[model samples]
Target: MKAKLRQLFRAVPDTWKTSATIRSLLFIVLGLLIYLPIMSDVLPKTFDLNVNTVSGVTLTAPVTVEDTEATEQARAKAVRDMRPVYARNDAVTVHQLKLVNFVFKKVTDLQGQTETTPDAKLKDLKESSPFALPGDTMPALLAMPAASLTAAAQETNKVVTAVMQKGIDQNVAREEIQQQVNQQLVLADLDSRTRKIVREIAIASIVPNVTIDEEATNALKETVRRSVKPTMIYKGEVLVEKGQYISEQVYHRLDAAGLLERNASYLPFFGLAMCAGFFVLFLAFYLSQAHRDVYWDNSKILLLSSIICLTIIVMKITSMGKGINFFLPGYAVPIALGSMLIAILLDTQLAVICSVLFAFISGIVFNYESLLPVDFRYVLYGFVTGVAGAYSLGKATKRTRILQAGFLVAIINVLTIVALYLLLSSSTGWRDVLNQSVFGILSGMLAAILAIGFLPLFEGIFGILSPMRLIELSNPNQPLMRRLLMETPGTYHHSMMVANLSEAACEAVGADGLLARVGAYYHDVGKMKRPHFFVENQINRDNPHDTLAPGLSKRIIIAHVEDGVKMLKEYNIPKQIIDFAQQHHGTTLLKFFYHKASQLSETPVSEEEYRYPGPKAQTRETAIVGICDSAEAAVRSLASPTPERIEQLVRRIIADRLEDGQFNECDLTMQELERVTKSICETLQGFFHNRIEYPDDKQVAVKQA
Candidate 1:
């Protein structure tokens, strides 16, 4: 049954990971897609740029015209003729006068048309089409203005195609089409005054100087000419005829009316920058992945992500404070990336490199203009804040500390702003200083708050285990440790002693003393499952060993190491601590059992079976524990522990363990072993500080020893 269960659990990992990988890939693609459109540029920078313009750009008339009054007359004629017609009456009436031979024929016998309804009217269209009028068919069509008629006529493809395909030469056909269109427009009836008022409206428009590639320009020109000129009026009189004067208002009016066409590819270029920038950021994240650590894992990936987010935020910020031309003396890039440097990367040295990169990026983004020198103060600000942030919060950082560091950064940012302003601006006023100072202070706090807020997200995203999280987990109130203490007090006490010795030895050897201590605290947690089997908690009681035979005793006790490993697994304790529990008692002889077994039966029973099954101590901390656990028990067993005897006993036990090959797996040097021996002797001396007595001084010791 147990073997079957193990086989079942083993299959879960592959299935789980394969599904997770596929899901993660999908989300990554989705996120990348959504993020691209918001990048620097892709769509038109100004929506107005794509609008069809309503006026020309040439306000500069031909030099051949030389009269101010002629310009005025020309302007008056333009305003009168070009004004759009409006209907103030109760009903909208259509005008149809002098219908052309082509227009009439196209509606009937010219082409394939059995029914009047065009474009195959649907149910919805059938109700909405003007041809489905309330009255009888062919009510007298009211005459309409030429411009409106021409615009509507643009949809008359049959008429236009007929004119083009006629046997007439191209030039002659075009001229005839124009003249025929004008005659039809003139005959279209309206109030006499309305017709007279709109007599000189010209059909000219303004196109901007677009700097597109040849193909795009040609296509644009074709589209504009067809969409605009084909829908214009050419009747009665020409407004702003050949010699009209154009004013700034007219130019602006035309520009607003969809006549503007400036074809610059600045938009796509900006989008390209945005994509490149994000790609660079992701690349930085990839390179920084090598530095990720556990309990020490924050890396350049976190810093890079932070910078990317901050760069976007600062760009938005600068946009809000528009017209900062050089006003931003420094950029926000360095501060953001640098702030995350210490917690993630673990190397303060690499932080400055990040800062320089951020500085350059900030200068590009936050710098006020394309021309003139960038005030460089933003770069300086970014570099300083980043370096300072990284250095300040590099190790053992808590959330509050990260935030406090940001506040300190804020102060520095303010100072930097003030200094830069004083150095570069003219007549720096108190108001200006105050504003800059406030902005700097706010920015700094934001940096700190943002960093603190994002740390957990990064931790989860990158599988980073931070020291702060480890410390919190190590706290005694944590569920696992608390259970150990409450359910297995003796094991807990023994673990504590081991922790102290190991921590001290680890510190003495320049190792991670905290990790050693934490590991030690939980190393023997498995003993809790069978606490009474150990002698540490056998206080005020007879020796259980007296009742049990040596072989059974050795087996029961030797089994604790394996038992501990089982317990560690059940609790899902980390591998490092489990290693200590398994190896602290190396495969050494349990001599007391072998001696007893020999006395009972001299048939040469193997001593190897009585020993522990171990791979031995593999680190200084585990080795220290093995020595200390024995030293403490041995010293406690002595009936009379004089200082010299205790020292001798400590040395002998250490020697026995050493020769038994107990410390072989660990990297403890001879010098370190001697130090460990001295340290134990010294610590024991403190614990057993009751005064020594001479032969005659047993009675006197109570009074004066």
Candidate 2:
């Protein structure tokens, strides 16, 4: 039972996921809506409008009274206005219809309002009962009403009922004429033709001419089919109820209004909303990434961020098919933004792992719907390309380097795009393929550029110190380290030794050897300001501590650490190195001086006076440095160095560190500590190995120094 409970608990996130849960929920909810348009049948077979060239006061007269040549005359006039609408390059084609988000649904629940007016603007623009509030704006982009819409097309009877009862606006007649002339007919020179038919219609209405009516009816159908729309519609809706006929001229009117666009009649705003949702997710992920401290450092956020990236790619694919993509791109923006910090401040491989997961998750998230094979090569190539660029650029301190690396990645992306395009699609025309190839390479480069540009934002946000930063600091020629080498060569050499030991110990426990090495190099910089006070630089021979009392000697000795921090601050040492320098000694006692103080005093000497003022080690690297520093010093004092003696000394130092609570807050465990001791002993033993004496007896002593 306990094991089961532990397993259940272990499966839970180590950190809270308030934001992740919200985003995941958002993805699932929106995905369902996007996919719903694929299966419904009551959708319109086509979006071609039938009502065109609405003549002056062209009213939907009651069907109860239509037995005359006037109807025939109307049909004739319809033909003349229409021929130009379908004529190629005539500029009078009916395809120039608009489908702006602004809606004007013809449906009214109670049929007619009896007052001719525009539609009510719908707050829910994509709903089945599409309507536009008088004040609301329409979609800016025009839609070609096509055969694909079934859902909204089925509502024609309902639409006709609303139209006949409510008597749609007189202004609608004028707007219809204006839309044709301004949007289509005028440019096609149908301006003159439309006018002629209207004049003839006026003559026919007054005279009741049969031939003219037939010509006019044909003209209207031709004139309104200027636009075409292809739709993915929903199931079972009233496409054209009991009282409608295709020849009733309602299709013409619907097409002109954009309601005739196949599936659009049911969900007018679907595509636009998909695009908008994508933008929303983009912005959300961007804002989420903004909290670098919370998202960049936490492993869960890093993992989930990849998931978010892939989901967006999938959403973009499913939202509008393959038509909307640019070139192959990755979560390079987030991954690169987080990489340097993770590499420099955390761990290199973890950063690499984060990037790897980001690439693969994109495949899972991009849910394609067609039977046609999905081309994931772009995503795959982009991931490989992006991760490569991120790791390459992550080591840099200069912002420009990030961009430079990104540019290179962009080139790789383009190649991948071209190659993948070829493999996925069999079209081999270089003229056609060249553009894609050029674009693909450029896109990859752009992703890198974007990543580079975004790096500073995250760096500043997270306070990340990169590898380049650490390396810049590790240079012995740097001002502070140089000063140490010049003013106190002995202390500098001592630091080198500590760095060697620390680096070895750190490697034993799988910590970054570079950081440990770098930290050890600057750990004793404070001793530089007062070289004579430390034993290493006291070469000319008088011991400064010999002239002083034990307590004063301890004070002087402890003061070096404070002085070093101040000097480092003046020279601007980075905080990590300063931490290692200060914390490595911790509050460890100065046994030699403390014992002297105790021997001389009538009252007992307090341990506080002899201890180094320090914060305990906060990281494994710093704790390893502390142990190594003590062990190195203690080993130097060993009377006869041997493998066992060195091992004993290293163990005692680590044991003492544990006992003193030096590692209380650090993550170093007993197992890791033991490994560190073994490594240090192995290193020291090799360095101080005993050799067999030569029979010549002129053998040199082992190089103990």
Candidate 3:
């Protein structure tokens, strides 16, 4: 049963490697997992309550929503408080002033009638007047002297113009205007009867000059209504206290907030779905554009999805205890764990993108008492911590470096949390600050511990060669490296030179330099099988190959490639390292052995038999290692090499390989190849530069004395 279960587990990765449908399903599952935490509040928890009832428990709004009834009431009140708008009609004032002047002119004309008696003139004046006067006032005006009459008429015009200029509304009574006119005429230089007549004429002439503007009044009320904001039932706001009476207002608030029993709305679900779908699509698009290898590989896609889901799960769990008589539990979420793991096991650029995605997801999961779907505080904290972890772990070559990265992440977390608290908090408290700081520190440390524990598992299951693992394999104390050192010291030393050349060249061309270095270290472990038969290991001894037939020599020389593959497999080294041992000597002709064999046989020798059995260099690193391997051996053959010879030799090897089509399998460009050539030449020149001779210690001491 155990063996069958192991088979079952092994079959899963094979399916993932071959199936595109499974890879797409993995992304779909990731989107659903992201939507899980926010699902809790999408459909709010409802309570049974009515007006005038006592509440059993305190209820907080699960989602933000508009209180429509309350908003309407607020708008109605705003309209009621707004004052009416009025407009003045200058045309009415002008007409009233003209009538006043005309009335006085008619009085003067009637007084100038020579043939009419005073009673007839008075009757004529009354007939011509625009308004009626008191029974005795018309006769008094006619009987007055011309100077007094003119004075009264001028005073009346002045009083009418003054009263009308002060915008009298239709609501103003005529009695008020009469009283104001009486006061203005009291200082007139005329008899009391003439003054009374002037006052009545002025009062009649001053019609109401202002009127209510219905359009203006309505517009003012509308402006006031629009200025009033909608009444909102914010998320996590308390609608009713424990054991408090559910008044009509509180009951309506609960109903509007969806806390009272009602049909659930699907709008929130649709909104969350859209958000999750958009995020997933964005992540997929980023990977396809920036890291196509990960996008095309099912195992890598699965690994990325798993890490994001696991981080989100941790965040969701942390958010469950949020606001449990505390400021926040979100500070304890190890959001950086996903970023650090991706940086160590995958691409650092991908890790950076994942950090931002994780931060946003955290905001959604921990959105407590927030007006927005995402809480910016948690977003800021998560982004800072996750990015710190990723950048700090980018160059980690040792296991303990993960812990050190964790400490750095902790420091960043503490600074971020404290800064956010101080910036956002209205009333800062020392105890809450201390608690949040502690949580942040612990969160970073916990992320590190978890990363350390999970790194090996991920590497083992997915067959990934992280920098840390490659560094571990490069150690001289490893079993294969130790065997190579003890059995063939000459080959080991030669391998080190090739490692330096390969690393420099690969780095110059934007390839994996560390992988190239590690691969170069074990590239020649096959030479240890028959140490003395190879040229490098044969010290102080006659050449064994000179005694043997050329064909026999060729067989022994080519056996190392096959022998290296067998031994590396038995030792369980990573396949990437083994590829170096296998493919570094691609299918180029072994011309030295082939020429010697052809000279002895008196016939043409088959070039295929003398060539290394190869699938060719399948990656830039392997191709670069192949070039460096040949270049190093060639330069070392010179008795005394110079910079010119080293440059010529490196370029020749690269040109020969390119002409032979050995680099056709990899995506190495000519520009990259040229860069590799330059880099290799510079490195070899440093290695083989001339050195000055030094005096012996005894001679130096004698000269000094």
Q: How big is the positional error of residue 458 in model 2, measured in Å on the Cα after superposition?
A: 5.5
Candidate 2 lDDT, 1-705, residue by residue in tens? 433433443366644344566546554554443334321211233433344323222223111122223444555555445533221121111111111111222222212343433233232232532332122222210121222122223222222222223222223463443333233222332234333332222211121111223445555665544222222211111234334554444443343223444525545236435543664465336436654433433433333343334334433443343323543222222233344334434445545554543343333333232211122643475366646654666556565676676566656655665676678576556665666656555544555454444434333333344565666678888988888889999878878888888788888789978788888888888787678988788898799899899988888888887887777656655556778878889989999999988899999888987888888888999888888778877787788898889988788887877898889989998898888888888877876788886644334434332
> What are the lDDT scores of the predictions, listed in order?
0.54, 0.53, 0.85
RMSD of 3: 7.5
Which is the winner by lDDT between candidate 2 and candidate 3?
A: 3
State which candidate has the highest lDDT. 3
User: Candidates' TM-scores?
Assistant: 0.51, 0.51, 0.68
What does candidate 3's lDDT look like per residue over 134-221, in tens digits?
7877777667788877887788888987787888987888788877887777777877767777887787778887887899999888
Q: Of the candidates shown, which would achieve the greatest TM-score relative to the real structure?
A: 3
> Candidate 3 has what TM-score?
0.68
Greater-lDDT candidate between 1 and 3:
3
List residue ranges in candidate 2 displaced over 4 A: 1-384, 388-412, 423-428, 443-461, 690-705
All-Cα superposition RMSD per candidate: 25.2, 26.6, 7.5
Worst 10 residues of 1 by lDDT: 200-209
What lDDT would candidate 2 get against the real structure? Answer: 0.53
- lDDT for residue 392 in candidate 3, whole number 0-100: 91
Model 1 TM-score, all chains together:
0.51
Q: What are the runs in model 1 whose C-alpha is more than 4 Å off? A: 1-341, 344-375, 394-400, 427-433, 443-467, 545-579, 586-619, 639-668, 690-705
140: Cα error in model 3, Å = 33
